[model samples]
Target: MSAEEIRRAAAERIEEAEDVRDELCAALHGAGVVLPSLRVEPAAYADERPRPLVELGRCNLRTARLIAEALRRGGAGA
Candidate 1:
């Protein structure tokens, strides 16, 4: 499938979830997109931060764009 198609599929999967990031990663993996190693961490200053923090070790630009588009389509902005 094309990258756009993969991205859309991933977004649809993510949208079905109550929590998105993990599901998104799984969907991408299922689509044969190898994501970089990463960790999700609670914001150090939760009172000051609006969202959780994620640390991505390394990712290709195309994969990053796909993830961003998926998040946007899923109503979860990246």
Candidate 2:
């Protein structure tokens, strides 16, 4: 309705996105992998709906191998 309401809703969505990203980071940490560039995608805020996105950015080759190994070992858990 109001601009304030819209901003509040958008903030909530951003918080949810950050929460999801944090959860994923914790899971990856448990699996002995870390995504140094992991973060919420800033572009999502520019959208009409403001549905935030989690961005798993680039990592080093060693980190890539770690993720791959975790996935290969943990299957759905990774």
Candidate closest to the true structure, highest TM-score: 2
10-70 per-residue lDDT for model 1 (tens digits): 5554344324557756787765565776545434223232344444558889878877776
RMSD of each: 15.6, 2.3
Clashes of each: 0, 0
Clashing pairs in 2: none
Tens-digit lDDT track of model 2 for 1-78: 888888888888988999999999999999989998899998877765697879999999999999998889889763
**Span of 10 residues, lowest total lDDT, candidate 2:** 44-53
Off by over 4 Å in 2: 45-48, 76-78
| Model 1: residues with Cα > 4 Å off, grouped in runs | 1-24, 27-33, 39-54, 76-78
What TM-scores do the predictions have?
Answer: 0.35, 0.82
